[model samples]
Target: MQAYRIVRDDLTQPAVLALLQFHLDEMNRWSPADKVHAMAAERLRAPDVTFFSAWDGAALASVGALRDLGAGRGELKSMRSAPDYRGRGAGRAMLDRLLDEARARGMTWLGLETGRPQAFRDAHALYAANGFAECAPFGDYVSDDFSLCMERGL
Candidate 1:
């Protein structure tokens, strides 16, 4: 695995924007329109969300965000590793950073919504390995065939 430096992102860098666009595109390709829950760059910049990116030197490797859901809860959003960086520890590094931030904010739990297709298997495995378990729908999400919700206690 390559060394990664995970830092808070302003979502203004060209590379960051490109990666996020790619993420949204891929999400649309794999899921129905209504089932696509990936947030755009604008939503990611909301005051309640703190976005972070993992970098390999100057190259963007991955991106993730933690959205304050109030009441000691947080929601992980927009986690994606660049194509070349997948399986290279960048995603895990970003996830670790988000988890740390949630803990620091006194969050009692962290939840996420992801696709349920085979294309999302790796992501599901990563979260499962890190102690996340299948959960009911959270926040504005509703139970659906195309979506999988998972959560882990902080």
Candidate 2:
């Protein structure tokens, strides 16, 4: 695995914005609009959300965020790896950073809502490998055909 420098991002950099847009576009392409749960750049800038980007030297490799859901709970948001960075451990590195941040913040659980389509198969496997399991709808989400919710104890 290549070394990745993971750090908190303000979501204002052009590369970060572009990657986030790509992530939203891909999510929309793979799932219905109503079922798409990826947050926009503005939403990710909220005080409770800590956005992170992983870089390989000067190039942005991946992006993710952890949102405080209150009561010792947190949620993973906007996880995406650049096309050239996929399969290169950048995403996993970003996930590890987010999990570490969650634990540091005293979160007892971390959950995420992702697509159920085949396009998201790899994402499911990655989350599962990291100890997340399919769980009931969480937060404002409800049981849905196109959404898969997963959670892990911190």
Candidate 3:
């Protein structure tokens, strides 16, 4: 599989939106008020956000975003793999590419907020496997039982 990092407009609108909505639907199954859908949509339209898509042949396998927080800090936002692509390491591959891009841009730290509900156990394990450690909340997120904050210093 090859991964592509493209300008926002380079993405096919329906495909990208479908990926985002799928993630939102998955999250909503557990946390109804996560509000990540709106936030991701807004960020996807922002110039400061870098979005990447991983493709297997011509099929979109995963999507991930990295937002510049200024001062050498970056935030990971809206990372998900298509349902048919799960369990195939697409998420991990996409995350590794995002990390490389962030470091290339001179980011000193990477932070992300993820759901902490039982439904998110696999996600939590993914982050932990990549060296992200639990940390205090970052970005616009407040401390909540349903969410967790994690960071990895570059």
Candidate 4:
């Protein structure tokens, strides 16, 4: 397996911010503005959210976050791989780290919201391959044509 460090990363770096903005912009393009569930940068830094960036050597390869939703539930948020590193293992590594974190925290379930545009097919496959299943909306989310809700029990 490829080796990369998944570290607790802050959004202070310009590159990180720019990459995250690109992720959000892509989401905006795929889904309606009202249906985009990506967390704002500031909110990603909140106490309940654990944000991480994957680093290969000195390069930031990807970013992801896990948010505690109380009562043993967790949510995956803001997963994005650097454009140059898209085909690499960054996304898988970040996801494994988040799953580890959630399991360590004794979370019973994990869930996420992702856009359903054709652009998101790879992401849909990734989540499904990782054991997520399509389900009704959870938490504050509502049914929407442009969004998909998925969950897996830990």
Candidate 5:
């Protein structure tokens, strides 16, 4: 139930990779080009990003990351929860932790991209409930029918 940020390392890499794969597979299952799946673990290894992992004592339950875009803006990336842990509030906890991290870093706004498919219904609801309002495309993403973008001011 405790979620926190950590370095990208051997112990955490596998879990992160699994989460990334889950997102990829979900996208492929719908429409391959519809989802913009990014390698979060690799991105976290960059100097301008912060990565977090959630653990339920013995295992990795979820993970999320934030990439600084400078000028007080940040993009949410690589969020995923283990299939066994879904619908148990792990995603919300991960998001709350990431938001706090964003604020601490002097970021005034945070944004994210999620699939617009039925499989992402829960994710869309979670973000909406967490104060993120639908927004136009940010980062390298362009507005598309299959992608939903949202943003929140810290």
Candidate 6:
């Protein structure tokens, strides 16, 4: 069995950087440059963003972040499970960790934006399965058929 666990990450290690790059590259393929909203790995180290990595022993299983959006709101950011680790519960573990952290930090809401293409179908299902329902755009986003915004109260 995989000894997988989630840990607070600083986003500076080579493996973590690779995961962030992978996520960004994938986003670039499916989203227009103008619509890409994922923060760079270095940028995620800013004070407001809490980044986490799911690890299976020494291997990186997945990475995700929670950005403090102020007003007791948080945004789920950069949810990416490494391809090699998909279907092994890494994604779910990372998400649940973020959600638990949000509640622990007193966030009243959590929101996220994801692409509408087939690349994101599994992601949409994961979010919905975890109580995140589709909602109107939040933050600086506008309504977009190519983008799907979802949120849930914390």
Candidate 1 residues 52-109, lDDT tens each? Answer: 9999888899999999999999999999999999988989888989999999999999
Instruction: Kindly give the stretch of ten consecutive residues in candidate 3 with the minimal lDDT sum.
Output: 1-10
Those runs of model 6 whose alpha carbons end farther than 4 Å from true positions after fitting are: 1-3
**What is the per-residue lDDT of model 2 for residues 1-154, given as tens digits with 9 covering 90 to 100?**
7899998999999999999999999888888878888899999999999999999999999999999999999999999999999999998999999999999989999999988878999899999999999999987887677888999999
In candidate 5, what residue range of length 10 has the lowest lDDT sum? 2-11
Q: Any residue pairs clashing in model 5, and if so which?
A: none
List model 4 lDDT by residue over 1-154, tens digit each.
6888999887888777888999888887777878888887999989999999998888889999999999999999999999988878889999999999999999999999887778888889889999999999998887676788999999
In candidate 4, which residue pairs clash?
A: none
Q: Is candidate 1 or candidate 5 better by TM-score?
A: 1
Each model's total of backbone clashes: 0, 0, 0, 0, 0, 0
Ranking by TM-score: 2, 1, 6, 4, 3, 5
Candidate 6 overall Cα lDDT vs. reference? 0.91
Which of the two, 1 or 4, has more TM-score?
1
TM-score of each: 0.97, 0.97, 0.87, 0.95, 0.86, 0.96
Candidate 4 TM-score to native: 0.95
What's the lDDT for candidate 3?
A: 0.79
Clashing pairs in 3: none
Among all windows of 10 consecutive residues in model 1, the one with the lowest summed lDDT is 138-147
What is the clash tally of candidate 5? 0
Per-candidate Cα RMSD to the true structure, in Å, reads: 0.8, 0.8, 2.5, 1.1, 2.5, 1.3
Per-residue lDDT, model 6, residue 92, is 90
